[model samples]
Target: MTYGPDTVSASQPLLQLRSLSHSYGSVQALHGIDLDIAGNEFFALLGPSGCGKSTLLRSIAGFETPAHGEILLDGEPLTALPAHRRPVNMMFQSYALFPHLSVEKNVAYGLEAEGRGKAEVRRRVGEALETIGLTKFAKRRPGQLSGGQRQRVALARAIVKRPRLLLLDEPLSALDRKVRAEMQLELKRLQHEAGMTFVVVTHDQEEAMSMADRVAVLNAGRLEQVDTPVALYAAPRTRFVADFIGTANLLDGTAAAGGILLDNGLVIAADHTLPSGAAATAVVRPEDVALAGAGTGTLSGTVVDTFFLGGTSTVSVQVPGLSAPFTCTVRAVQVPQRGSQVGLVIDAARTVAVEDDRAASRPGAAQETVSS
Candidate 1:
C-alpha cells in the first residue's frame, strides 16, 4: 500500500535537521537530533511524556529556537524565519476554531490575512470546505459542529494555506476512542489527497504505527530509533526500542556459543553475532511463544493466569527463575487451565538478540545485532 504521496523523490530530503539540540534551564530537553523527511511523507514523532517530542516539533515549527543545530526545509535555512513568516502551519490539539466565525470564514482566515483578493478567497474557501467534506456546513459556527467536525475544520484551515509543511501536535487526543480511530483513517486519506508533508507528534504507539510512513522513537531527550513501523517492531536496535515500541518479553542473559544463557541455566536458541560472554537480551513476542505439554518444549512452567480476548487468550506462566511471568498468546479454545503445568516453546527464528544497553556503558564493551 502507498503510505505517502505518489511522486516523492528519493535523492533529496524535503526537510533536514543537523544536530538539533535544545535545553530548558539546566535540564536538556532535546539532544543532538538528526532527521530527514521526504517531500510528502507522513512521519511521526512518538514517545512517552517528557521525551522531548513536543519540543522537537515546536523547534521545527519555529515556536522554539534550538540551542545548537540548523533547521532546513527544501535545503533552505529556516532558523532565521519566525513562525508567522515560515511557509508552515501547525494544528493545535485544541482545534482553536473561532466561535464567532462561520466554517468557510474560519478556513478563509489565513488567505484573508495574506491580503488575497475577495474572489480568490471565495474560491479557495469553497475548495477547502469541499476538501474536508464540510461544504454544506459553511454557514454554521464552530459551536454548532461536532468534535470531529471541528477537527476537520482545523485541518481545513491548516491545509487551505497550502503550506510547504504541516505540523500536528497530538491532533486526535481530544476525541473519544471511537472518533480517534475513525480520524486516524481520515488523517491518512487527507494527507494523500493534499499531497503535503506531515509531521505528527503523539504519545500513542498505535496511532503512530497506524498512520505514519516512518516513526522516530524518542527517549530521555534522545532518539532511540527511526524506521518504518514494521522494522521498528520486528528488529528494534536497542533495549529501549524493543521495550518501548511494543509488548516484548526481554530475557536478560549472557551470550553463549549460539544463544542466550539465562540465569536459570536455560539456553534459548536465537540468531545473534554478539561476542561470547557478552551481556545480551532476547526479545520475544507473545505470539512467538507456544504452550506445549510439559517436558515437550524448552522449559516448563505453571500457568498463573489466563485472559480471554475474543479470538485469542493470553496465558501468563510463572517460571522458576524469572521474576515476571512469561505471556503466551493462544487460541481461545486452546487455553489451558490455571495452575496447569505447561512447556514454553519459543520460536527461535522469530526471536531477536540485542545488546544490553547497560552493558554498552561499560568500558571496552560493544553492541551487536541479531543475524539473519
Candidate 2:
C-alpha cells in the first residue's frame, strides 16, 4: 500500500524513538524506551500516575530532553529542533486555550504566527471549525464554551497548522462521562480526517483501549509491553500487566501434576507447566468465576458482599483460610442474595498461573485496571 508522500510503505517511519531515556535528578523517569508510529496510527502510552507516560510524551514533544536516545519525525532526526521548529503540536490536559481570544482567533493562532496571508488563514480556520462542528461558535470565547467545546477548540488550533504529528496529554480527563464519550468519537474522526499520527498519554485504560491502535504500557520508568488492547488484556506477558489491566483474583497454591492446588483444598487447571513443588498463583478474572450449587462445585464459600450494577452484579464471597474474599462478577439476574451459601467454579481454560515471589500471602489480592 502507498504510505505518506505518495510513496511505498518501505520509505521511512512516520515517527521513531530509539532507546529513549530520561531522568530527573537521581530518579529515572523513562529507561531505554523504543517505539515507532506509522502514518495515521493512533497510539497510546498508558500506565499509572507515576509510570512516566506523560514524561515520555513531553520528551517526544521536545518539552523535555532525554539523557539518551534519538527522536525522529518523517525519518528525519529531531535532535536539534526546538519545539516550535518541529512539525508537532500538543494539546494539553487543561485545554490551554486563550480565554481572551475568540474560538476562530484561537484556531488561527498558529497559522497567523506562520505569517500566512489573511485569506488563507481564514480559509483554514473556517475549515477547521467546520470539521469540529464549531463553525457557529467561532465567535465565542473559551469562557463561553463547555469543557468539551473548549477541548474541541484546542484540537482545532493544533490541527489547523497541519502538523505531521499530534500529541495529546489526558485530553478527555476534564469532560463529564457523556461528554467524554462523545469527544472520543470526535477525536477518532479527527485523526482519520487529518491523516496524521496521533500519540496520546493517558492513565485511563478504557480511554486508551478505545482510541489507540496499539498501547505501550509502562511502569516505574520501564516499558512493560506494547500490543493491541485485546492482546494485552488476553495474554499479558508479565504478572504486573495481568494484574494491572483488569480485575483479577490471584489464588496462591502449590504446583501439582494437573495444576496448582490451593491451601483451601481447591485445584485450578492451568496452561503452563510449573515445578511440582513450586508455589504459584492462579490469575482469574472475576467475570470468569462461576457460581454453582454448593455440594456440586470445586469450592464453597459464603456470599458476603453484592454490588448491584446495572445489568450485572459483582459478588464477593468469604472462604475460610484465604486472606481476602474471592469475588465473582455475574449478571444481576444470575446472582444469589447476600449472607447466602455459595459455590465458586472456575473454567479451566481461562485461568493462568504465575509465580508469586513476594510475601507468601496477602489479603485482597484482587487487581484493577489503571485510570481510577
In order, the Cα lDDT scores of the candidates are 0.88, 0.82
Q: What is the lDDT of candidate 2?
A: 0.82
| Candidate 1 ranges with C-alpha deviation above 4 Å | 1-8, 359-372
Q: What is the lDDT of candidate 1?
A: 0.88
Which ten residues in a row are the worst by lDDT in model 1? 363-372
lDDT of 1 at 108: 90
Tens digits of per-residue lDDT for model 2 on 133-172?
8999999999999999999999989888887888999999
Number of the top candidate by lDDT?
A: 1
Which pairs clash inside model 1? none
- lDDT, candidate 1, residue 311? 100
For all predicted structures, in order, the TM-scores are: 0.94, 0.89
Model 2: residue 40 alpha-carbon error in angstroms: 1.0
- Report how far residue 281 has shifted in candidate 1, in Å: 0.9
Report residue 231 deviation for candidate 1 (angstroms): 0.8
Tens-digit lDDT track for model 1 on 128-208?
788789999999999999999999999999998888889999999999999999999999999988889999999999999
Worst 10 residues of 2 by lDDT: 363-372
Model 2: residues with Cα > 4 Å off, grouped in runs? 1-12, 253-258, 261-265, 273-280, 355-372
